[model samples]
Target: MSISLEQVHPLIGNKFQIETSNGIMHLELVEAEERPRRGVPESFRTPLLLIFAGSSRQPLAQDNYFIEHPSLGKQVWTIAPTLADHAKGQYQRPHEDGSTCLYYQVFFN
Candidate 1:
């Protein structure tokens, strides 16, 4: 079965594995959920944000991968590099070592 955004929202702060050509890599759902659309009604269509975090060991700069979740099953997601707005400090994820990590954002209709 395919996985939906709603099925992933609740899994925030949890880890999920991705099947890659190299091997199995893992990532954590740092953020998820739909943001209130500017003009669209709350029930109509809200923007969804599926952000995943990974360490230097796992690189997601390649193509899409198949993500497998116990409840959500497996689904393919194309991840892209997301730049954290410097103006919006809240969107930034800083590490203890002063190195900011990379965050991949997935968009789906």
Candidate 2:
């Protein structure tokens, strides 16, 4: 299912347990901070990006996560059960009527 950025931002740095159709997905918002880079031209400026994700079990595993920024974009990442398993989905976008919608599903089992 899809969730809004506003709805999820407050939960950063906290543990989250969500009930999915297949099973429970345990997520922990590890760290959220502004990523800084040096070497870029002074004319370039990056929007504030926030990162959030779930803890993993594999050795040296990378956390399942998402990155969001007002101007850049939003992205979600999760581990695949196998190379053959790939799912597609979409995210929420606000409408002219001020209504929000979310339509996405990512497999993490």
Give the clashing pairs for model 2.
none
Q: Give TM per candidate.
A: 0.69, 0.28
- Candidate 2 residues 1-109, lDDT tens each? 3443454456664544444344555444432333354565566453234332332321113335453433324555552221111232212333224443222223321
Residue 36, model 2: Cα distance from true site in angstroms: 1.7
Candidate 1 structure quality by residue, lDDT tens digits, 7-46: 7778988878888888887777877766656787656545
TM-score of 1: 0.69
What's the distance in Å from true for residue 59, model 1?
Answer: 1.7
Per-residue error (Å), model 1, residue 2: 7.0
lDDT: worst 10-residue window of model 2:
82-91
Worst 10 residues of 1 by lDDT: 90-99
RMSD of each: 3.9, 15.8
